[model samples]
Target: MSVTGGRVPDHHPAHHRARGRRGGLSPVPYVATTTRILRQLAGDHRSVAMIVVVPSAIIALMFFMFQDAPRRPGVPSPFDDACLIMLGVFPLVVMFLITSITMQRERASGTLERILTTPLRRLDLLAAYGTAFSIAAAAQATLACVVSFWLLGLDTAGSPALVFVIAIINAVLGVGLGLLCSAFARTEFQAVQFMPLVIVPQLLLCGIIVPRDVLPGWLQWISDVLPASYALEALREVGAHPEMTATAVRDVAVVVGFAVLAMGLAAATLRRRTP
Candidate 1:
């Protein structure tokens, strides 16, 4: 407030303080948002099923598909090799779908607008979303990895714990990317549509189906930049090495960098308008 004019100018300290209050973080709002999101997700049985059941089902299906395939003595089963990476990829895809659609629904239904009217800063809201979904992602990855390693006989030459950790990170990466992409979608259907555009290309180029070195020069360059490529590379490293190597560490770092970048972009793009 200005003493003389009865209006605070842009240069006024009071104006700056008020702005900081509106934009600053508050633990109360952050915890409330996280709990509210978790409660809502719990009530949505289909989303719960997607998070808990879908990834394991996919892994099971893949296991059966390769159950009887021939392999030379002392050789790793092709399924084991694929399953290591798929464990990460499956949760990632599922979390991406769930996160993007859920955010789109919130935007289209005016929930975001109501939330923004509160004391919740945009960054706090996004951080809460990240925390909530990352929990879901961790559960999703754990279940799938358990089913793969125990029930399906999926083998890894490396530490299974490391594989599990990477799987969770991959799922978190999906959540971040999903949040970023949801900002551009006005409808759930459009959010779904982004999966093919954003995820499918990375799938084809992520060195799962073909060796990345065998890919064309352009494709190799493209793969080098996709987060999924780094994720797969890390998983393959865990599958082939009994211990974590520098390459795996580097790849995981790259994936984490991309995830953080996506979260930052998502926060920047958040809006109070109902879509």
Candidate 2:
């Protein structure tokens, strides 16, 4: 309980007290909630290091590992391909775990219930979470791209900015997926469990490990339906040819559409305890 001037009151999550006005889908609460998450993230040095710094460091290592490595005349460079895909994949990994686990914690602690008592709608809360994480995802994507292209000598055919944009969109896609997954998890551990189930398949089938063309026709069909495939495809196009082709545009659109769909599913998962 927080000690006020005279009366003792139950403590609330920082997000509940965040800069929200009591009304329908108000921006005040949304911004306040987003700021609240940023504040928590900043304070947690370990998390900041994990989310912001570690991905860049890993990408740098990939650069150094292959900057001068020998390759066959006609063989594909798995190392370089991995690095480009990592720029799109790491943000997804980080955001999915954070959003899923954070939502589970909120539900466990009654934070969601309390927030529902106020004027906040489920859509507003989901948007705040998605917006906040997408901002963080953008930073993560930008850092990975900078290190990969600038320090790591990641050769690319596409413009660095275009690849970076594609990476950011994919990361936001992760945020949406995480939020939807969180609704089914009753604990943080359960949330983490979904990582392998939800994320690993994409890594394996998204044309990152094996080009979809070479995969069995059935597997290629599966990859076509996954959002990660489009993201990886878009990144590869820019890194390989650096063109704004129709294929790249379609993939980008598909990824963004899924992100919106995920957020809508997340909104439906809200606890209807009060309203």
Candidate 3:
């Protein structure tokens, strides 16, 4: 008996071919989903401006207005410490802006629910956003470094590698903190409201304006816990005194520890918010 054209014989190759095609197409959806998230992040003007303007302005002010001040006998001069502190502060500012803007916009437009309808994993979404923000932060940090060096006549003692490494770490840490704040914030306004909480405390406690050693004993302990303190210490050690090989390595480790800790907390917070 002849089978009809529409009827497939047992073990037909077409069936298997269709299965393979579907398997291949499965990843396309996920890739597109990730790209969508990244595009959204890139298109946000407030975040873009923040990543560009804040760090650039801070570095410019540090280099031009104060580079000539005399170094105290024992302390690193304000010029030496200014860039280091800026590295720490700039990232925090960038993180706050990006996280606050993105999350708030999503909440306002009620698009977050639509995004959650896809098969895209939560961690993947977080990773894509973090990667985009990190790129912007890295670009800002680099521009700040180049402008500070060229116009302010600031010197890194030819240790360009160290400067790049420091800038990347700062950017990563900033993204992490921003993510954490976004996760906790109920709205964009709430996220922006956290700036004074994150930024002001760091300014007062991070050993920038007031040396950590000079603080009262209890206040010194508080400064020690601040992530910016470690970063400022690391930057000052590397940028100001490139000749101190052993000290630079130790300080870098301290900064890395803070970055890792902030990232870990942010990841945990994201995981909780994902479901």
| lDDT of candidates 1 onward, in order | 0.87, 0.82, 0.67
Q: Candidate 1 residues 241-269, lDDT tens each?
A: 99899999999999999999999999999
Clash tally for model 3: 0
lDDT of 2 by residue, 69-172 (tens): 78887554656687888888898889899888888888888888888787777888888888888888888877887777777667777899998888788878
Ranking according to lDDT, highest score first = 1, 2, 3
- lDDT score, candidate 3: 0.67
Model 2 residue 6 distance off true place after TM-score fit, in angstroms: 38
**Colliding pairs, model 2:** 19-32, 20-29, 157-242, 158-242
Model 3: per-residue Cα lDDT at residue 25? 29
Q: Which one is best on TM-score?
A: 1
Residue pairs of candidate 3 with colliding backbone atoms: none
- TM-score per model over all chains: 0.92, 0.86, 0.75
